[model samples]
Target: MLKKVLIANRGEIACRIVRTGHRLGVATVAVYSDADRDALHVRLAGEAVHIGPSPAVESYLRSDRIIDAALRSGADAIHPGYGFLSENPDFAGAVAAAGLRFIGPPATAIRAMGLKDAAKALMEKAGVPVVPGYHGADQDPDFLLGEAGRIGFPVLVKARAGGGGKGMRRVETAAAFKEALASARREALAAFGDASCLIEKYIAHPRHIEIQVFGDDHGNVVHLFERDCSAQRRHQKVIEEAPAPGMPEAMRLAMGEAAVKAAQAIGYSGAGTIEFIADASEGLKADRFWFMEMNTRLQVEHPVTEAITGVDLVEWQLRVASGEPLPKRQEELSIDGWAFEARLYAEDAERGFLPATGMLAHLDLPDDLARVDSGVRAGDRISPYYDPMIAKIITHGPDRTAALSRLSDALAQVRAAGVTTNAAFLRRLTIQPDFAEGRPDTGLIDRHLTELTMVHAAPPEVAALAALSFSGTLAARKTNDPWALLSGFRLWSGASDFILLEHRGQPLPVSFLSKGEGNYRVLLEGRDVDLRISSSPDAFRVEVDGRTSTLHEVHDGKATTVFRDGESWHFTLADPLAGEDEAAAAGDRIVAPIPGLVKLLHVAPGAAVSRGEALAVMEAMKMELALPAPRDGRIAEVLVSQGEQVLEGAVLLTLEVEDG
Candidate 1:
C-alpha cells in the first residue's frame, strides 16, 4: 500500500479520501486554494499545502501547482478526487512524470475516453452500441446545422470535452439551432477550455443508467452493476440509486457485459463509470440502450454502488494503484440490497434552482436513518467559488420499497438554516407519483416542476411558533420566570402581546392573550388558535387545536426558523417603522441575481427590447444564467462590461423611464 497520498481536490470528495486513507494507515496530504484555507478538508488531513487563489483556474486546475504540492508534502501517490483535474489526461501524465503514483487509470485510457465524440467513435469500433450522432471534426456552423437537420428535430448539442450538463442544449427546431449552438460553444470553452461540440439525436423520454466498473493492472476487470439516475433537473442528476428499479435480469447482464468490454477496450484501470442513455419510451429493453460516455474517475454517486455491493470503491482504487490484483472475480460480486442517494444542494428550488451563498448557522442531518456525506459544518459558508452541494443523503434496505421509504423519512428529518436548500424539493421528488412507482425519466422533474417547486405556505401553527419565538415567549417558558415573560399585563383580563412577522414578503400580525401557565389564545390573520406551549432548550412541545407535536426553532436575530418533520418555515420580524420602497421593487433596473462574471451583453444603451428578451448572461458556479427584460422597455444605460465580476444585487443596466 502507498504510505503517503496527496488529495488533489477539495470539498466533500477530498474529505472523503482523507478518511479512507487514515483508516488504511496511510498518511494524507490535502491541497487547498485561498477560498478553502479554513475548509473542513484542510483540517482533516495530516498534512496540508496551499495552492493558489479562489478561482479554480489559478488553483485546482493547475497541474504544476498540484504536483509541486504533492512533492513538497512527500506523498507517494496523488488521488484526484472526482472533479477538478481528475479526468485530465495531461495531469495524470504529469503526476507520473514527477515520480508520484497517480491513483487512477493509465493516461492512455483517460486520453482515449476524455472527449465524448472520440469516445463514442471508439465504442462503435469495439462493437458496443452507440447513439446515432455526428461525431465529425468539422467546426463550420453551416455544416453542424445540416447535420442537426439530418439527425432530425429535437437534437442535443453537447460539449465534447466535459460532462455535468455544462455546454449542453436541446434544440427542438432549426430556428433555435444557431443560438443554442453559440451558447453551448461559449459555455463549453469557459468550462473545459474546449469549444468543440457534437450533435446527438435526443432520445425523448430517456433514462440515464450507468455501470460501475473497476480494473486492475493485472488485466482483470469486473462490474459492480448499475445505477439509475433518471431523476434529473436541468440535465443534471438529482437522485441516484443502485440496482435500477424495473431492470430486467437479462438487460442488467447485457449492460454489465458491455460495460466490462468498454473498460477492457481502453486497457483501463481503477474506478470508472460507463454511462448509457436508454430509450425508455417503450420501457427498459435489452436492446434499447446505447453507450453515452465514460467517466475516467470516481463518480459523485459511487456511494450507492458501495452500499449495494458492500465494497469500498475508494479502497479498491488505492489497492489497484498500489499494483494489487482484483479483489473479487466477476462471479464473486453480488448485489445485497437496494440503495438511494439524494443530493442536497444549497440552492433555492423555488427560484429556478438558483445557487445560494450564506453561512450555515444551523445544520443537522439524520445519521441513524441514513448516511450523510458532507464536508461543511455549522458556521461554514457556502461560497460561489465551488459547487453548491451541501451533502448527499444515502439510504439502503432489503427492498426498493423499504429503501425508498427510508429515504423519505430521512429527508423529512433534515434541518438546515441560514440558507435556502432543496431538502423539501428532494422529499417531494421521493413521493412524486411516477418516481415513487419506479417509472422515472429524465423529464420527470420538468413534467412535474410546477407542483414540485410550489412553495408551501406556512400553516397558522407554524406562524404562531415563530411569533412565540420572536416575542421571547418560548425563551421565557424555558426559564419559568414570571419577570422574563414579555406579555404586557392587562388589569381586567390577562397578559396580552402583539407582534408582526413577515412570511414570503407578506406581513402577518399575531396577537395572543396569556390565559395561565403554558396556555394562551392566539389570533393570527383574524383566526383564533388556542395553544398550550412548553419549551426545553432544544425543542418546544406545543399543543395546537387538540393536535400535539414537537418542534425545533432557531432565531438568528433577524429571522426565526421553525422546523418540523424535515420541513422548515422561516419568518422575519417585521419592523413597523420600515416602509416599502416602491422604486426598488419596480422592474426598472436589471441586477445580478448572484455574484458572477458577466459573460455577455446582449443589449446596449438605447436598445429597444421586448419583454422576456435575453439582455445579458451571467456565469456563476459553473452555470450560465441569461437575464431577461422584465418588461417591454428601452435600455437607458449599461453599468458593467463583459468579463467584469459583480456581486449579488449589483445593477447591471437600467431601463429608460417612460411617461404614461
Candidate 2:
C-alpha cells in the first residue's frame, strides 16, 4: 500500500478520502485554495498545502501546483477525488511524470474516454451499444442545424469535453437550435475550455443508469452492478440509488457485461463508471439502453454503490494503484440490499433552484438514522467560488420500500438555517407518486415541478413557535427567576404583551397573556389558543390547544427558524417602531439574483424589451441563468459589461421611466 497520499480535491470528497486513508494507516495530505483555507478537509488531513486563490482556475485545476504540493508533502500517491482534475488526462500524465502514483485510471484510458464524441465513436468500434447521434467534427452552425433536423427534433446539444450538465441543452425545434447551440458552446468553453459539441437524439422518457466498474493494472476487471440517477433538475442529478428499480435481470446482466467491455477496451484501471441512458418508455429491455459516456474517476454517488455491495471503492482504488490484483472475482460479488442517496444542496427551490451562499448559522443532520456525508459545519460559510452542495444523505435497508422509508424519515429530520435549501423539496420528491411507485424518468421532476417547488405557508403552530422564541418565552424557561419570566401580570388585571413578527414580508401580530406555570393564552391574527411550553437541552415540548408535540428551533440573532415534520419556517422580529421606506418599484432596475460573471448582454442602452424577454445572462456555480425583463420597458443605461464579476443585487442596467 502507498504510505502517504495527497488528496487533489476539496469539500466532502476530500474529507471522505482522508478518513479512509487514516483507517488504512496511510498518511494523508490536503491541498486547499484561499477559499478553503479553514475548510473541514484541511483540518482533517495529516498535512496541508496552500495551493492558490479562491477561483478553481488558479488552484485546484492547476496540475503543476497539485504535483508540486504532492512532492513537497512527500506523498507517494495522489488521489483525485471525483472532481477538479480527476478526469483530466494531462493531469494524470503530469502526476506520473512527477514520480507520484495517480490513484486513477491510466492516462491513455482517460484520454480515450475523456471526450463524449470521441468516446461514443470508440464504444461503437468496440461493439458497445451507443446512442444514435451526429458525433462528427463539423463545427459549422448550418451543418449542425441540418444534422439536428435529420436526427429529428428534441435533440441534445452536449459539450464534448466535460459532464455535470454544464454545457448541455435540449433543442425542441429548428428555430431554437442556434441560440441553444450558442449557449451550450459558451458554457462548454467556460467550464471545460472546449466549445466543441456533439448532437444526440434525446430520449423523451429516459432513465440514467450507470454501472460501477473497477479494473486492476494486471488486465483484470469486474463490475459492481449499477446505480439509477433519474431524479434530476436542470439536467443535474438530484437523487441516486443502487440496483435500479424495475431493472430486469437480463438487462442488468447485459449492461454489466457491456460496462466491463468498455472498461477493458480502454485498458482502464482503478474506479470508473459506465453511464447509460435508457429509453424507459417501453420498460427495461436488453437493446433499449445505450452507452452515454464514461466517468474515469470516482463518482459523487459512489456511497450508494458501497452500501449495497459492502465494498469500499476508495480502498479498491488504492489497492489497484499499488499494483494489487482484483479484490474479488465476478462470482464473489453480490448485492446485499437496497441503498438510496439524496443530494442536499444549499439552493432555493422557489427561485428556480439557484445556488445560495451564506453562513451556516445552524446545521444538523440525522446521522443516527442515515449516513450523512458533509464538508461544512455550523458556522462554515457556503462560498460562491464553488459548488453549493451542502451534504449527501444516504440510507440502506433490506428492501427498496424499507430503504426509501428510512431516507424519507432522515430527510425530514434535517435542520438547517441562514441559507435557503431544498430539504423540503427533496422530501416531497421522495413521496411523489411516480418516484414512490418505482417509475421514474429524467423528466419526473419537470413533469411535477409545480407540486415539487410549491412553497406552502407555515402552519399556525409553526408560526406560534417562532413567535415564542422571538418573544424570549422559550429562552426565559431556562432560568429560575420569577421576575424574568414573561408572564403578563399586574396588580389588578391581567396585562397582555403584544409582539410583531414578519414572515415572507408579511407582518403577524401576536398577543399573549401568560397564565403562569408554563401556560399561556395566545392570540394570533384574531385566533386564540392555549399553550403549555417546556424545554430540554436539545428540544422543546409544546402543547398547542391540548395536543402535545416536540419541535426544534434555531435562533441566529437576526431570524428565528422553526423545524417541524421535515419542513422549516423562518421569521424575523419586526421593529414596530421602524417606518417603511419609499423605494422604487420592481423592474426599475435589472439586478443580479446571485454573484456571478456577466456572460452575455442581449440588449444595449435604449433597446426596447417586453416582459420576460431575455436581457442578459449570468454564469455562476457552473450554471448560466438568463435575466429577463420584468416588464415592457426601454433600457435607460447599461451599468455592467460582459465578463465582469458582480455581486448579488448588483444592477446590470436600468429601465426608463414611463411618461405620466
Question: Which candidate has the top score in lDDT?
Answer: 1
lDDT of 2: 0.90
Cα lDDT tens digits for candidate 2, 1-660: 999999999999998999999999989999999989999999999989999998898999988999999988899999999878998899999999889999999899999998899999999999999988999899899999999999999999999987778889999999999999999999899888999999999998899999999999999999999999999887789999988999999999999999999999999999999999999988989889999999999999999999999999998988998899988999999998899999999988877898888789999988999999999998998887888889999999999999999999999999999987899999999999899989989999999999998877866667777877777777888777877774445877665677789886678888877777787788888888888878889788888867888889998777998887788878998777765332344448889988888989999998999999999999877767999998898999999999898988898998998776
lDDT of each: 0.91, 0.90
Instruction: Estimate, for each residue in 1-660, the C-alpha lDDT of model 1 and write its tens digit.
Output: 999999999888898899999999989999999988899999999989999998888999999999999998899999999888998899999999999999999899999998999999999998889988899899788999999999999999999998889899999999999999999999899888999999999999899999999999999999999999999988789999998988999999999999999999999999999999999888899999999999999999999999999998999999998999989999999999899999999988987999888789998888999998888988998877889999999999999889999999999888888988899899999998899999988999999999988878887778888988888777777775667764565688788888899886778999988887788899988899998887777888889878988888888878888988767788998778775465444588899998888999999899999999999999887677899999998999999999898988899999998776
Candidate 2, residue 80: CA error in Å? 1.1
Per-candidate count of clashing residue pairs (backbone under 3 Å): 1, 0
Candidate 1 has its poorest 10 consecutive residues by lDDT at 577-586
Candidate 2 — number of clashing residue pairs? 0
Report the number of the highest-TM-score candidate. Answer: 1
Model 2 weakest lDDT span, ten residues long: 578-587
Candidate 1 TM-score versus the reference: 0.94
